[model samples]
Target: MTAPAIRTGRAGPEGGSRRLILDMAARLLRSGGYHQTSLREIAEAVGIRKASLYHHFASKEELVEAVVNDGVRFVDEAVAAALAAAAQAGPRQRLEAAIAAHLAALHGHGDYTSAAIKVFTFGSGPVPESVRLSRRLYEDVWRGLLAELREAGGIAPGRSPEALRLFLLGALNGSIDWYRPERFDIAALSREFAALVAPNGVDAAK
Candidate 1:
């Protein structure tokens, strides 16, 4: 059976109070590590009583899972858009465009990216297998793009596409920790990153 569909956009009340709780939980998870974040804090952040928080999420672990699931959904959408664009363009152009799209999503959706990084890098205890699988699917999106680029000769011939993919992914994903829009724009940075890894090794136009 297919996995349950991950929720996106503004989850309405049909998603119920649980949706509100998850939103607040996601924010807290972004600002603080899982251990540092508390249900009480999430409730307060939502302007609800601590007891009411349980009505939505049973425990901290459950809340964390929701946060991860939500984040994965956000990333999936971004990657999907990039892939769609890549399909219509040459490898080099597509890679550059895809990187720009990814960077735009990351910089524009700071809270989502922050929560995703926290869950992926340092979650408390063992995460549920479902959550792990969701994260894997998220990573696979980039891997697929990199593979397509390599097969199309967009990437250099001698380099390991897998290694280059990992490096690019690491740099792109790690931007969540230090990226500041005020200091540098997303498009410029995306171009710079793409140029650094381009097969010709030439700097991308500013």
Candidate 2:
């Protein structure tokens, strides 16, 4: 995939230098992950001195905090829009719409979304309370979506909504590791994932 363009100068049209830095940091973090990424590397990638990077962000953790939050916000907004657009649809369809929106956001905002998932899931060390809270808010969106499906009897009889949320999210987020648009598409992937909640339930491969 092509790298996100970083506008230069003290005030870039792309939300200025701060935005540029975050974009670059997210891309690097997606590839190197949190532990492997550093302020210096982000600075270099953005074509700025480490000292200049410090002007925008005091520390590496601070920079990552911003990127992680942006990541969640991007997906959150996309799913919200999808749900709103599908308001008249049945609970199952609404849920499927949410899944499709989520997949689109994950792949579309590749750097930010993947960085958020990688930092939270694979980064070694304590995850900040701020990061956890941000994630919880995003999770609540899924909780609400799943609750609607449960209330409408759209979910499989034996599945726990909470467990299903985790399972579905795990599959969706885990796609970052192997999902390739060239080989397959997000729309088909969303349908296959949504099938898990179908009344008959989907059979797992033995």
Name the top lDDT candidate: 2
Q: lDDT per prediction?
A: 0.73, 0.84
User: Which pairs clash inside model 1?
Assistant: 13-16
User: What TM-score, to 2 decimals, does candidate 2 have?
Assistant: 0.88
lDDT tens readout by residue for model 2, 1-74: 47576655556456477988999999998988987887889889889788988887878889999999999888
Model 2 scores worst on lDDT over the 10 consecutive residues at 197-206
Per-residue lDDT value at 195 in model 2: 81
lDDT of 1 at 126: 79
